[model samples]
Target: MSRIAVIGAGIAGLTVAAELAAAGHAVTVFEKSRGPGGRCATRRSAAGPFDHGAPGFEAVTAAFAEQVQDWQRAGWVGADAAAGASRLIGVPSMNALAQQLASHLPPGASLRVETHVAAIEHGAPAGWRLRLLDGQLNAGHFDAVAVAVPAEQAAALLAPDASLAEAMRVTRSDPCWTVMAAWSDAWAAPGGSWTAPDPTGVLDRVHRDDARTGRVALDGIASRWVLHATPQWSADHLGAAPAEVIAALTAVLAKSLGVHLAPPVHAAAHCWRYAQVPDARGEPCGWNASLQLGACGDAWHGAGDVAGSRPDGVERAWLSARALARQMALSLTPD
Candidate 1:
């Protein structure tokens, strides 16, 4: 079995790790965060669990649809018919999908959370050496390394390679200003969710957490809403402080609803610097023959064909991960 190191614990990383492990290869995943599911995140606070990263996932390919069905049958995810487009979300939280995938890794595979791999370098006989954020190098050498992070993060790690860096640079992502608010009983939700197509508007979509998951009320709030600012608006306000962004977005929310709403019981703003992938080209993944380095993520593929009627970012991540794993597996084995 080949010793492989997969960096980042998002869906892409986990998918690669699981695939390699199932193929009888020893795989170790390194994640910077406390948990998995990079962009497929769910934040829990006094207000409740907020799906601030990706609202949900939709399958475009039949193979991915079958995987989603497996997740559904396994109770790791559930369908949200109200979301339309066969959208599905993690049962307890969006990260549950990543966590579940990690749990099923083979005996030779393992995951390391809160371990930030700062850099990767070729170590001659050792193949690849991982430099951690704490100025220490990982003791184990790997036959291959897969970078399954956002384009910016991947760029930072793979800066030594001009071609890989250029490939990552070409794929651009947009920032997002997200507002999570818990309302009192005074104001009721208008509906499950709403999207604004106006370019000038601050919000692109507003989701009612209570209606989406039926779990927000447990936080002792009447209703909860997640307000996502449009790409242009988020870019315009990207430099603003968190409090300022929250205030402006909250005002925009009420205005967009065309109702005079009271202040929320709880409100907070989160800025996702690499929120959505607007452009992607070349291939589903990038790899170096001599360096044994590769990159893959949602940013590898564009928003998908057919515009608004295509798969979401999470599915792109999955597809990219699968493609990367297939390449890595083929290379590691010989006839």
Candidate 2:
């Protein structure tokens, strides 16, 4: 079997690793974070818990639906038990989905969290060697490698290789600020997801947790809201202090909602510098065989501009991982 190294334990990386392992190939995932879930993560606070990253996922296409079904069957995700239901979220937190995807990894399949890949070198005879940022060298002759990191980070890591660097350079992503609030009182909206019609609006989308169906807790005593800022707005103010950004966005959210509410009881802001896609070419996934590098993300899929655009993020990552796994499977086959 071929040894494969999947970089970035996000949905894309995890999906690829699972597929490759199921195909009998040895797979290893390296993640820079303390845990999996990447952009689709949840953060816990003294006030409550909020899915600060991806608020929820929608299964549009058959492929995405199948994936969701599998996750649900595996008990990784659950349908929200709220009013007008049309989405799914991870139980307890978003990371549960990633954790479940990784559950069935073969004995040879492994994941290394908090390990940052410093650089990758392709040896003519020895195959691919991945160097960790901590200077701990782990050598393996991988038949293939899939990179699921943001385009900019991927570009930096693959800089030593000209062709791979160029491929990454062409991939770009946008940034945004996610403001999370846990309120003491409940709030109602027309739908589970709301987009401000104002072009110059500070908030792009707002999700009310209590309004979602099948939600674990909607005690009305605690309400969670996520405010996603426009990419341009986030970019312009990314360097500002976190508290200041949160306060400003909280104000904008209050005014936009036509409610003169005070700053949320608990408010926090997270900045995703590479949050969305950037008008890239090709399909939802791309691979460079010569460089043994693959790229994927929502940007590669669509602009993720639809009502249920978050699923595209997982879809793009899975597509890229699947492409690489198939290639590795072929290459690792006995002659």
Provide the global lDDT of candidate 2 against the true structure: 0.71
Residue by residue across 1-335, what tens digits does model 1's lDDT show? Answer: 78899999999899888888888898899999998888888889787888888888788776678889898899888876457647788877777888888888777789999999999878678688889999999999998899999998888888768889877776789999999888766574466666854355787988777677434466468777788998888899888998898888878776666778787888888999999887665466787866777888887652235334345578778877888888888878522
Q: Which residue pairs overlap in candidate 1's backbone? A: none
TM-score on alpha carbons, each prediction: 0.93, 0.87
Write one digit per residue (lDDT tens) for candidate 2, span 1-335: 77778888888788778777887778889898888888888787766677777776676666677877877877777776552355678876777788777766766789988889998878777778888887867666676777778877888766646765676677777788998887776554454666765456577888776555444453543577788988888888979888988887778877776766754677888899888665554555556666566655454552233444444565666655665566655555422
Error of 1 at 40 (Å): 0.8
User: Weakest 10 consecutive residues, lDDT, candidate 2?
Assistant: 302-311
Instruction: Give residue 134's lDDT in candidate 2 (0 to 100).
Output: 76
Q: Tell me the spans in candidate 1 whose CA falls farther than 4 Å from its real position.
A: 197-199, 214-216, 302-310
CA lDDT of each candidate?
0.80, 0.71
